[model samples]
Target: MGDDHSAARPLRADARRNRERVLQIAQEALASDGLTISFDEIARRAGFGVGTVYRHFPTKEALFEAVLLGRIERFVADARALATAEDAGRAFFGWFARVVEQAAANQALCDMLDGGSQAGPQVGLRPGSTLADDFGAALGRLLARAQRAGAVRADLTGRDVHDLLRGCLTAERRSLARGGAVRMAEVFCDGMRARTY
Candidate 1:
């Protein structure tokens, strides 16, 4: 999903195909192995040479950043779409749960959200960047809509919700039993729900 938007000439057809293949392979590896997997392993899995992998992404950090940005873009798109739902509370909570579940299963996402990776500080997403801002803005819109509908607690801010999400991810990541993450997410949703007198 990463593209070259620089002033450089466009890639040849074969080169473009190879780049896409490497990105796809790296995406899968990040999901399963986080940043622990090497470019050599990616090259081997991609059925290409290491030089091919380096041609597109000279460093492991570059490839990881590209993959992470792509994933975040997709998530932001989903949040934007969900913001239009008739049931604002369900839309917000449902999307939240799905994100937690998916991230719990994804090593790269978990590590990124945790604020660092085993590979080093340069490999993870930084706060206040365009990618984070886009996601936050989309989520903030959903939160505001839910609050206006009286489906969510009025006292909660977007940052509060994000903190809660991080907590849910942490709980899920640390839970020893299966379905712990799902259960914890449900608890969070319940806590976020508005109370009726």
Candidate 2:
């Protein structure tokens, strides 16, 4: 039984490395070329055979899901890191701006997060998933901290913050190549701040 369990263990080191490499290349391709980027192109860019790509992600949808999930996980981690920042307001606004900038730079990633992909079903993410919960929790903590510090309005909720970020994306689409989203984020942050006068 011990030998059988060992044989059925997780991927070998090389295989794990290959999988990670493939995912990285897939993210780049998706960011630059959108969802239309083929698996063959990803394999080519990664310097791996098409078969290897297939071994890692059996279908195109699976690859898309993996890339989207990885991005969300990273965003959640960033939010968590900001939760302990010395200046709650700066951390909240800075992270908010960074997320908007990332969305502007990578439309594909933004679309995936918004569930605009036809491959949504394949991604298997649902409303109550742990990923969503963790992301929400992190954002909630940041917003609460900012509010308690009197850096942000007490009336705002996490949903309001999300809507504000979505507005940034809309601005980005209208002014592609000009980075309007980042500017919009700055203005939004200013409005969210408490006004003493």
Candidate 3:
């Protein structure tokens, strides 16, 4: 019988590097150019051929999904690192800002992932292992800690906090820029803190 390991297609070291480069470039393109960036431009910038790019990511939607998912994983890992903040409120605000920024970028990703767009199906995505869930869990942990410390109100669930931030991100994109977004997040955080009894 053939070895189980050999049955799998092992990515050569160069292929692995190229794949990672494609993901990084895709993120830059999405951040700078939004969802409609050209896959051909991405391939040229990454020093990989069009075929190589397609080999790593089959379509434009797939490339965007990979970029979004990759950023989410990194965002989650970063949020977990904030579990040791000096002030619970600061910690909460810190991650709240992170979520807002990511969501601003992910609005396009959500359109594709949630069936709100015409982007074709993407491969390799599992049911629940998305950046959205990862960030949501991290935010939940932070919010719970903050509420327990009386830094946030008890009436607000993590879902409420997330939805609130999503609204802020979406709104800021249409009419405001980065400074407006920072102030908006601070205002929301202040409102979430419980007043002394």
Model 3: clashing residue pairs? none
Q: Which parts of model 1 are misplaced by more than 4 Å? A: 1-11, 117-119, 176-182
lDDT of each: 0.84, 0.81, 0.71
Q: What tens-digit string does per-residue lDDT give for candidate 3 at 1-197? A: 46765655465766888899999898888777776778799989888789999998877877787777666576678778877676877788888776665656555543433333334455223336555577678878888888888888989997798668756666656535544534566666777889997
lDDT of 1 by residue, 63-146 (tens): 987887787778789999998999999999998888888877676776676555444687555688787888889889999999
Q: For residues 26-119, could you state the per-residue lDDT of candidate 2 as single tens digits?
A: 9888888987899899999999999999998999988877887888888889999999899999999888888877876677666655555433
For model 3, the stretches where C-alpha displacement exceeds 4 angstroms are 1-11, 102-131, 175-182
Clashes of each: 0, 0, 0
Weakest 10 consecutive residues of candidate 2 by summed lDDT: 117-126
Instruction: Answer with 2 or 3, whichever has the higher TM-score.
Output: 2
Off by over 4 Å in 2: 1-11, 117-126, 178-182
lDDT of 3 at 31: 75
